[model samples]
Target: MVSSSSAPGSALPGSSSPIAGPAPLSLCAREPRVPADRLVAEMVPPPRFDSVRFGTYLPDPNQPSQSEAVGVLEGFAAGLDGAPASGARRGFLGFGRSKAPKAPAGPRGVYLDGGYGVGKTHLLASLWHATPADPSRKAFGTFVELTNLVGALGFQQTVQTLSGHRLLCIDEFELDDPGDTVLVSTLLRRLVEAGVALAATSNTLPGKLGEGRFASADFLREIQGLSAHFRAVRIDGEDYRHRGLPEAPAPYSDEQVTRVAETAEGASLDSFPDLLDHLARVHPSRYGALTDGLTAVCLTGVRAVPDQSTALRLVVLADRLYDREIPVLASGLPFDRLFGEEMLRGGYRKKYFRAISRLTALARDAGRLVDA
Candidate 1:
């Protein structure tokens, strides 16, 4: 938990920056390193299952999906091209290229932010990976991995490496240390003045990242002004962290699903709350929602629906018992019928299906096609 209330010009966790003076890199904040084994074993999941059938193929790029990526790109391109666009939207990127091409007009210091589970990392990574690679035009992305860059190694080394890149992408930019904030501020200011196109992802908006140390009003003023230099695109929906991985949904227990009655059964007790609590603890994202359990059924496992421009793929299992097929079962929230592009209707719908191609390996390794 962070202290939302703090005195002026103070730093959190013994870290402070000269708010109005020389920024120093000596004694950078010490953040712990993530165990590499965990990353190798768990962070990366195994392949998808091959046995089960998943519903409708995801929308390909030839068609538009429910996602707002195209719109974002169009709007952004308009900004660069010069036009009075609109408010911020989620899951989209900059739009068309401006024929007039005005200095790549985008808001500066605008930190792209959302809840913990949202697809901030995925979006950032995709942005970096997909960015047009032109050495003359540089693009760099760094996952801060800590509340600050104080303790992270290779900051200056990385700075030297990326300094010449015209386009920069910094992922996970949270400024927990005041000193680190000054360094970042300096970096960002220089980037802006140089007319470099910069993009970053942070759990905290630039100002709030240093909440305890920076004055909220001043922080907001500076950071928001920074945002004005870049285009602020909000990525919404459930956490992308849970969204995709090449894994199959295997039945944990066959008996659990088979025990269900042919007809509706009565409640054993109030298991819903416990189940929800379990989900909150295990899955670790804001993207999931508990649908009706038919008054008695308990969800033994869950699958996160990952949001992508191509498709909204769902996670599910191989057991037939888990399928709640009756019309009454569908009465609650939308999930079963919610095939990715089904709700979206437009000319772009056709192209979105291309996303399904990538899921092929995931399904084969971790899942069977859903029963027809």
Candidate 2:
């Protein structure tokens, strides 16, 4: 939990101390209030890793390559804990490299790149947990969240605010928009300059950022320049998100829907787009006013959410509903088809994947409610 004294910047709600810099441009403007508890909850390490030590990330028969990755991550975490630094190294890309250039003097960081659900987040979370606890000395969150905060608070102010942290852990380090790519580049440069260590997880390699739509030479060069600051390690394995979960049942049958309709006394039915719009208007609060006064939510017209922004918002809503144990009945499309092909390729993929996993579990729980 972030201590009151260490709040990122005076921009955050309830922060009293003024950051030492030029006055904020928009003093009265405020970002939507996202509960601090919710943000911290998202950053908390999963229970499975609570007792697991860095050295205990043993190799699995199914994923032969994971052992090497685990060792690399353990070393990186140790380095964060004051162990000898392993000079800047590139991620494992199955290519022999010539002798690398000497690393400059600075606090070190690591970038763990891998496939969706391949434990990059887990590794990064472990590092956060292993670090000695100090009030306001660490910042951990998804890259998107950091970027959103930067958007609400100006870039320089955000950097000044975050520079106080000894470590920054960012998940889903991806570049979609050319503007975001540039913003992230500047943010990384500033953070490094401030001597802050970063541990980030991403589905895309730094070189492959903005691969299809906005891949420009200048953008790629910026990514490469940032990549030089950290050792990039790849963790290759099958997505473990649904490995042991039961197969998702087919979309709720009409009889099942009718049963829910009969049992849920004040259930509200809504469209996916409507939900997305409500979330958009009220974000960074994941659940909006529409969710208030609702015991259950039934969403129809749930065909492929084409827009990436909407899909990401849906992930947050699913998380909120799941946390509250609110049953959801989704119709119009099967669980697997909720996102289009393009969404499955980029940074948004992992979020959508997690949303599907949680929603599938919630749908089952909703089914049980209907049966009861």
Candidate 3:
């Protein structure tokens, strides 16, 4: 399920009157793709004090609206069940080998810069929920994606969870306005040197994220440096906002979804061999690295280790592996994502428990695995 929040950049909608003067700047200009309704809903008044679901009902003023957020969340949720669409290909700048015509080490900063919507947050969430299998592995910290406040405090908070989590995924990375230049630039380099994997999504491109700011040059350099660290996979085609909405995706057959779902619902400790065989038989040529049965296939051919249930529920697989005290095998999975600090934690945190618990209940009903 792709996010349904993308706005068409080429043309504008809801145009009643022609411009009176020169063309407006991009920021003030209305986006063509996002519907007029969404913008209004986003600006809708916050929850009232007398509201029933007060604590939880309030939406973040800075984040995308409920509909857009739901688009991302639902798509993320579906990912917990099945594989992604064909159009969503990750373009790495430094992930593949020299012969592969792709970067090996990855572009520095690893920017997910692009237009609004199109699943940047979804990608970040998937990377977090599915990629890493190890608790000891290092990833970077996810500062408040809304505030972009990832500084010394963010890193410290992450250090508490486990050790060496190096992959940092920032959703809605919109720093093109300024103020974030000094902080982002200063800490980003340190993060790289510390061997942290950086992943971020933004509505603005690297050059534009810091546009017009005095720190623009430094920010650009920072982005370039970050790009050098990992490859940038751009989902440049259509806005996938309508992707995971209700009607189950029909691209792949039920057999594939069923097989993967079985792995998702299989014995907590068991990674079925049949699943690996199935992936070997069906793993898309472009996406074979997504899941190598239980192993995570690396672009550089590094045999990291095998976790469990790739080709199945990574949200579940990750937690199951953590419970079993296992390390994530970076050999094969659905996507090539970050494994550092930010990835260990994500929006799908709740799904991990739900899927595992649901699988556990099902297994007990089938009388295979023990409930206790």
Each model's lDDT comes to 0.32, 0.58, 0.32
- lDDT per residue for candidate 1 within 4-50, as digits (tens), equals 21222334324554244222111111112333222212211011111
| Candidate 2 segments exceeding 4 Å error | 1-32, 35-59, 82-107, 205-222, 244-246, 253-269, 284-298, 306-309, 312-328, 340-358, 361-372
Q: Of 1 and 2, which scores higher on TM-score?
A: 2
Error of 2 at 256 (Å): 4.5
Winning model by lDDT: 2
Displacement of the residue 292 alpha carbon in candidate 1, Å: 44
Which stretches in model 3 have alpha-carbon errors above 4 Å? 1-109, 135-163, 205-227, 242-372
**Candidate 1: stretches off by over 4 Å:** 1-66, 73-110, 135-137, 143-160, 205-225, 240-372
Tell me the lDDT of model 3 at 278. 32
lDDT of 1: 0.32
TM-score of each: 0.36, 0.65, 0.31
Which 10 consecutive residues of model 3 have the lowest summed lDDT?
A: 295-304
